[model samples]
Target: MQPLPLLSGADPTRALDAIFVNAPLRDYGQRPRTNDYTLPVLGMAYIATYSQRAGFNVAVLDAEAHGLGIVETAELVNAARPRWAAMNLLAPTYEMSARIAAHLAPDIALMVGGHHAKAMPDRILADPRMANLRTLVLGEGELRVAALLEDEQRRRELPGVLWRDPLLGTRAAGIPSGKPNPQMLGPDINALPYVNRAFLPQDPYQAAPTETDRRLARNRGTDLLKNAARTGHREANIVGSRGCPYNCTFCGAAVSANPDLSIRVRSPENIIGELDQLHAEYGVTAFRFVDDLFLGAGRVIDEQMAAFTQNRIGERYVWDATGRINVLNRLSDSELDRLVQNGLREVALGIESGSDRILKAMDKRIDAEMTERVAHRLVKHGIGVKGYFILGFPGESHDDIEATVRHIRNLWALADNSPGDIRASVFEFRPYPGTPIWTTLTDAGHSPDALLAYGDVDLTSDGADETMRQRDEFNFSVDIQFGDVPLARVRSTLATLTREQHQRNQATQGAAA
Candidate 1:
């Protein structure tokens, strides 16, 4: 397969059918430093490939991957002179995306889609900053985007599309009257093409630091070496599945939040084929499955592990994926061993809170006991654990946060004695639109605009030194506190958890030395 040409420079004579843009997470000039790694914008890549297959000339501009600011990104998109400009929007990056969209040529039709847009289509459509936005794609965008690009007359009637009507103002088509219809399903996952990396940046994406990398960096006493080592490894982000069945209150991807999203998974053969292509084409030896529910319960997990083993995926390349505690705990020792043999290096768990009350509040069925049990089992099998913890909830108490701190300590202790490593990623809760918590807060008189305006959390503080500020990008917290715990207390708790994580890393580095 011939690689598609990138939309890097201006060409006055050439006109692109569509140009997909992955907006920068923030204004680059404002931040002291950016995150160490930038994830590949696979969503844009998928849409671009699907559009290209349909005979539309397509290219991708990944502003986030290239560290382009809003102005430069807009300049590049304008330079491409594409008929349609498509951008993926998220809550944290909403302003950046909107600003970039505003800068595009007025004649270029703009389409916005992503979790934020899907959750707040009306707000996005009405926002004056994005007045030129032609349409808001509500759900999975491949089919709708292709339909939008190919036909003009039928756009207003396209399912899962929200467009403005001259007379009706903002109108929704093929969606239910009040909310997203749960019965509405997106395109079949297995039918889509493997994401074409030709549309992505040629350089390998930098990945999060691994335990071995950290150990080596600490021994060498230089952060530069660690970053270089991370960049040197070719890593790719893959999504084997989409839409989570769980309705966790804080999550925007929950079934309750995205009723139109139906859970779907690509076949093992399809997944392996993509892996093979990535390895062959770009030498990507490490892969991260960014799926919300990659390792599902019962038959789903078994079939995937069996297929991976048969394909000898682990032998060729190591991988990491998100897993459910209950589902992992259900796996027998033999099954766990097979997963390790198949090259399952680490599993990311959403251990939201330690208190059972808060867990019930968040609708996380698994309790601390289940998480601990699963952690022990995985570490025993020499698989690392990355536990995600949330410090505050709407009605969370001080004791609840204490319980969470204890939970992190317990998992760290489990890994301390075992071959596997444990990492704690703590965050202060921020409510996203359309999630259960958002509804709960709104019902209790919280203004939607106020919440939306809160924007990205500023994790850095004036008192923090450079080293602490460096950790800010890894941690996220908002100024507004919706939880019962005071905002200051929440921030303090976050600092404590973060400090503990650093101390543990240092201890491990010392032990290694």
Candidate 2:
């Protein structure tokens, strides 16, 4: 079966035995490409690996990294002719991903799952298009898929799994499907298995710093402190500490079983052990903590500092991480010094808004003051800080956006005092499924039609209200049409500014040469 605009005209049976339409971001929407990223999604790779271990023929079409559109990807699937597919994706992108799945899987047995099915299992069963679905594996999918494979007849025993009959109209119209609940994967992700490096193209993120590879490679935090003997940069991906605790109004609150899984981390020693391993095995020198938020400033960072001090492993490594603005705001100079002394050189702080009203609306716990304070502290500590801001939220008006731009102006002045000590990054608002914003906008009937469509708000715009220099928009996106402010005008301005910045940097490099 071919996807849209094409159908399988040849034998579908000979293409392959099984395939799961792996929908990468490109499989959902388009944006100016940045660094190339791997396709496995790490979590899905676990399922795929175990499935492959079960002796099933498996293939993944990582459309994002390869820059293949959905239609083009579906065509590849039809060509491959996998008779059975287990697929899933976020709810917002599910329509497109599923439509493609349906096209290439006309005769094949298809199973769809993800946060969507996990949140709305019965609603999915209402659709006849899903009638042919073998099973909708919810929650953790690795074990669920394995169990489904092991028990050909299992509507009776699998928790967290939903399925229609594989044999319809054969006197089994109302079969009780299995409910298989997969356990959450954590702390022991390293115990699972290494991903197939072959899935990536030549030098994923070739344009990115070498640290990107280290983050994805051997130094990945297993038990923390995994790299004890490393003398330099060691690449590692952060094992999430206490996965997000708050369900801010703009965020989907109930996505996890325990809403307030306060920040948790393996002992600093455990993380260091992993870091040592990466240096020993891969000669890695730099590290980036891939946590959503790095709030280990006081407790975790202090412990890590103590461990490093005790072990005499100082100045042997440098690292960067993402964190909430508040983390820096409350840190003392000494704590900041310890982080820098131990090689924590840079940090990314998410300042969601400059407007207090907008911040309140988004339930962002931090204010522009907090952001400014944090930026200053970071500069004083000699840590390069990157500020990420988004525009558009539940109740932000045009004035709110202007206020946000003003926040940026003020931040720029502050950032300028420590030139090169901090950089600013901005993105338009995107409503991810399972977040409060997604449900609220969707429930309130105001969500955008497509999650893939990039919005018009640009923070780095010269068109940004220059009148309010003190009112720089720190971290905000324009979710709604601004009253008098022409949107996307800022986007163009920022684009020009970015180009000019790049050119100037090149010129400086040339002159230095």
Candidate 3:
């Protein structure tokens, strides 16, 4: 049970041919702007698989996942000293990614891709503010990195080049997102092979299990957390589908220059066919689907459902996914039964806030009542529903805080170990870049990114900096309420914690030197 030895000193072998680094959260404004941090380093794991499949050496550096600060991450990266280094991004780490890329620059073939890359490839690739990057993978970086390293001719002669052009400002007219090569179409999630099942985190899901007597996936399933913990496990993530059809204003569309407008659903045949071989041949089981919305868009949920029906493995395996409360609402009794029949273990929902006001502000579209209905329904079906609630938004008044508290209480009361539901989680909100609310919150004086998300406190008026620090690790220590009381009431003393963010914002704003 000893902690994994962190190289006590710098070890050069850490970086062999490639090194994958997840950046740090310099500022922790409640929940910083780490978009896909919860997501296991799937892309890196994919590259790890590709490298292993090709017989090269690889290592994954999950700085953010491990809570390593940027300096700590850089130290680890420097120790590894891989010739080629890459980082993943969503909006929160946009600036940090740039800085990390810069820190490891001049020597490291630094690269980054994620929502930021997908949403604004050119802007990021052509970024003049941060440091210069080696080359940003245009579309799916998994195959691109593999292709680049595997074939010298193909890597050099490849169709896409998303690097910066000093003279021209940025590279252009390259391989579009739709342009696919025969070898890796839809990522032959089958042929690509699984990474060594050695590198996943140990008991990562320990925090999220439902059944009290149920065993870990291995007793019945081998999951991502376990695989990620292994020293040399090479794994890749499979996005069963892409793009979300429902219009939740806070959610962004997928990557930049992505030609596909509608979300693409891979057949259960595609997934299971490959998955069967993946598990049989490569001993792979850990998979994290990157679908903004997993199943089918609206009407075509049938196509995906049928795929599962035809290719569905009766049992003995599983995968985790995100689901629209409403999309799940569409499932009939039989379909819901099928999900339970198969291994649909966990479902994450953006029950962002209990306050109808904040939900409306985020354009969540789903009301608190709907959230409760969907949550109760999922739990009833035995699907572990992890409700994601948020605090803070521009217009949230103190009363809205009470509304959120009520929501949590309602959720808590719903969990009855004696004979009922028993699973949940909560998060506070911070505006992310490129989103509409990011600008809205900035204009409204509640932008926490300045002082909260990143580390470092401002010791100005009334200990605002300390207050911001407290907010980052802030927990609901008291009891509070909403809706008259009892029966119709929710919980106590739990505030959404967003409006206080503006307080931090104001202090930072006032203290700007």
List TM-scores for all candidates, in order: 0.88, 0.70, 0.66
How many steric overlaps are in each model, in order? 0, 61, 40
Candidate 2 colliding pairs, count: 61
- Lowest-sum lDDT 10-residue window in model 3: 487-496
> Measured by TM-score, how close is model 3 to the native structure?
0.66
Considering every candidate listed, which one attains the maximal TM-score? 1
How much lDDT does candidate 1 score?
0.76
**For model 3, what is the error of residue 169's alpha carbon versus the real structure, in angstroms, after optimal superposition?**
6.0
Model 2 TM-score (2 dp): 0.70
Measured over all alpha carbons after superposition, the RMSD of each candidate to the real structure, in angstroms, is 5.1, 8.3, 10.4
Q: In candidate 3, how many Å is residue 34 off?
A: 17
Question: Considering lDDT, where higher is better, how would the candidates rank from best to worst?
Answer: 1, 2, 3
Candidate 3 lDDT over 146-241, as tens digits, reads 665554334434445466655777564335346556443235454555444344332123332223213222233334434332322222345566
